[model samples]
Target: MRSAADRETAPAQGAAGWYEAADEPELVEHGAVTGLAVTGQGEPGGAAYNESAGALYAVMGALGAPMVPLEGRWWVEDARSPFEVPREEWRWHLFLRLPDGTATIDAARAEVCSGLPAAARVQHVSYTDGRCVQVLHLGPYSDEPASLARMESLMKAEGLVPHGLHHEVYLSDPREEDPAKMRTILRQPVR
Candidate 1:
């Protein structure tokens, strides 16, 4: 028999694994997750992205859910490599995971519409990345290409092909943390 307190502190089913990745490239399978999300097209750290993020945080804070790390799914419209595409052209869905049994979307929407009009664009969304290749990326965001290249090499060696958007779980706040000490989980869904 487990105590209620113990159950309360336990991670939700599959939640613990979702945010973890090895320093070296490896395969992982993520279960379906539900959360609040807002989509936009802009370079990370640009005005549009920052505004959207602020809105998301405001709504989440209003809901009183425990803060979770921010996550992003990114892609580009151009056929060229995402790296080659202009930063301003990047499309992204920013996500904040809601705790299990959190308030309904209607309530969240109402909260948004009432005082946080900017968050009106936020929506309740769910997704399953399924099988993926992920690795822990350390240092500044600019150095992520090397980590991504390593993940790509592992994927190729394992006969995997990318099947979903490029994903990142931000484990450090760039505004407060040292760029050299930033940690991010880079994930790529694959088939």
Candidate 2:
């Protein structure tokens, strides 16, 4: 078994298969995971979202933990199709995965008090996505709809239905990488 420190230093090994996907949709089972997470509502790149992400990072830094790739769970409130919902109405939980046996939540909370006020909103959360359909999306985020549509098609063909919010694991930093080269793992829990 790998030590926690080894896992912390090598995210791909730490996460097992959580961060991988093929260009085509495939079924995957994800076990429960614990992480530092913060919630928000608004356009993805809007101010509120950015601030929450910053706070999450600050708390992680305060814990002296290695940063992991950012992940998000996304949804909308309106009954209308998610595509039809205004971007500003979208809700999300942004998170950074923590290694098993990491610092305690109380310790994380204490660190928050000394960092960004928004860090107070951060929580150690856990959830399981038993079965999912996922794909690796390449290129600009704006082009994700096409990838999503593909996932939907796969789910339908397999007689599966959505069971939870959409999930994304960002493998490339949007601010620094060429949009054409961006890589993201898109996943949706299904039954």
Candidate 3:
């Protein structure tokens, strides 16, 4: 919605939406994330989504993850690997949070591809291959059903299965409210 500088210089808006976990590129934190393989079947909706734009930084701090701020357009794929847009949607994305210039996507590989063995509490992370639909959702998560529908339609038309389940790149922090105008990106991974 605004320029990179605007996203930064401009004081934290009342609330923000979601984007790719990688939309905000930054160095990795010094820990891990404790999460499971989240999935969202049905319409283009979301779950356990954050709603505070400014709180994102604090959330990252608590989660021990890293991220950068970005602004762009994106789409939503399906359980299969397909696209809602023709070319790669010019949406916002943050590089995976890694150990200072290391890498963040390894989580997806280890967690999704290999499947974490399960150990102690840490920053439960995940990774996805290049190319993912980044859907910029405006409104409450309940409205996400329609969005998911849109993504499913795109997948069916393109013959792409959203086999990777669902992942929400939380761009806002719920503690702050303003849900009605909140922003979030429901990322449906494609094969």
Candidate 4:
């Protein structure tokens, strides 16, 4: 994997550029990625979200891996838009990508124990995102809908339909960056 900065010059599939609504959505093919995952239902940036994130980093540290930015897959029941659901009812699979060759869950757990509130709930998993339509959302999370709409419009124009939950890659830490300058990659698996 390349640093986000390096990705800008790499390729569309690898570019880490923050896109605007006027920018065209890109279709990228991704291979399988391994990571530590935790599932929860509630508004993001809340206690449950924090604890799960802490546990993931704790496990990653145990495996001697560098701390990676957080990512998440989000969804709701009945095909309702995630925005249509109340924050308290949102469901998410939050995860951190593990470095290649990281130790197995059992092996890492034996060496370092996590005391985070959601530590026991963590799981190691791998999945292929396959084909996706993605755009860079460059502002506060609250403005994601605009980015998503543009992607959806592009997907529809291309005769593609969503194949899985919506995904987000946090490129800038909201804690340190101003909300107006935050960068996030918004992706939706598509066929």
Candidate 5:
């Protein structure tokens, strides 16, 4: 029989395979990687949903914990980032609804980040609303394939269908944690 370890490291959509962490995570303030925009929910110049959703998860990094399904608004305009890895994988990304004439996404992020701590990383934000279910996944990122399978099974059993994009909140930086023992949250938005 396959163990959890084998499932997580498996490739997922040509990227990191589905995985989960299994512990209560903590929270803290994080910075950078943000954007600004009017939340589609009707707030002018409000943050976009799904943009900078990683910020909340990043806080878990400060608390030595991980989070999942961070649904929020975010994005940065026209700014290539050094922190971002070049890949097609889903990011705990921020969404930003920009003005018709906004020059770049980074500019939007700067507008929103100004309200936050001076050191806050500017990122884009997007706005969205719907039923979303979340859970805390603990352990190595490699083991999440099984975890995701399990979550999918639960969703099926509950008669819930996936509605939006999946998300992961990285808690322990691989550089700091034992790869054999990592922490992250796997989330599937469903209805």
Candidate 6:
């Protein structure tokens, strides 16, 4: 049997199969990934949400960390279809992964000065998702439910239950002119 630590240290490269799922879901092992994090609840583009994301980027740059794609963990107080929830009710933790062994988060927190009030929400956080079910969603964000449904069905088949927040790695910027070309990795931690 593999030790928990052993499992965690394993490179996720061979785990790329988890990053690819078509018409179904696949289980994948993940290692630790660090993030500059901020928490907030509201529509994604709302003032508070945008500011929180802006603050994270500003702080990360100030701390001399290489820029990474934006990632998000989403959840709610009660279980319900995410599609059913009003945009205003959405809660999210927005993050950007920090480079390896860059600097202490405490030092980064202390020196964070983005001139943005949301900078106060910045914190260095690291976690290993362990195991997850994920799929690459190709197209607009609004159509994610169809992909999610396929994932849940596969999870049920594998007798898995979610143990963590719904996660997303934005592979393509939302500002792109063609929403049809947007690519997102939808991930859900499970056991």
Question: Candidate 2: how large is its RMSD?
Answer: 7.7
Identify the candidate with maximal lDDT: 1
Query: Which tens-of-lDDT digit does each residue in 71-172 have in candidate 4?
Result: 999888756766877888888999888766665786665444534546677788986777777887888898888888888886776677999889888878
Instruction: Provide the clash count, candidate 4.
Output: 0
Q: Please identify which of the two predictions, 4 or 5, would achieve the higher lDDT against the true structure.
A: 4
Candidate models: Cα lDDT each: 0.84, 0.83, 0.37, 0.74, 0.39, 0.76
lDDT of 2: 0.83
Estimate, for each residue in 125-188, the C-alpha lDDT of model 6 and write its tens digit. 8867777878888888888989899888767766678989899888788556687788888988
lDDT of 1 by residue, 132-187 (tens): 88899998988999999998887777667999999999988856458777999999
Clashes of each: 0, 0, 47, 0, 53, 0
User: Mind giving the per-residue lDDT tens digits that candidate 5 earns over 64-144?
Assistant: 322322323222232464125332321334332232233444433344454443214543343332343345666665465
- The reply for model 5, stretches above 4 Å from the true place, is 1-123, 127-129
Give the per-residue lDDT of model 3 (tens digit) for 126-169: 44333334356666665766776776564554455655435454
Arranged by TM-score with the best first, the candidates are 1, 2, 6, 4, 3, 5
After superposition, which runs of candidate 2 have C-alpha atoms over 4 Å from their true positions? 1-14
Better of 4 and 6 by lDDT: 6
Give the C-alpha miss distance for residue 60 in model 2, angstroms: 0.9
* lDDT score at residue 123, model 3, on the 0-100 scale: 30
In model 2, the worst 10-residue window by lDDT is 4-13
Better of 2 and 4 by TM-score: 2
Per-candidate TM-scores read 0.89, 0.88, 0.42, 0.84, 0.40, 0.84
**Candidate 1 clashes between residue pairs 3 or more apart in a chain or in different chains:** none
lDDT, candidate 4, equals 0.74
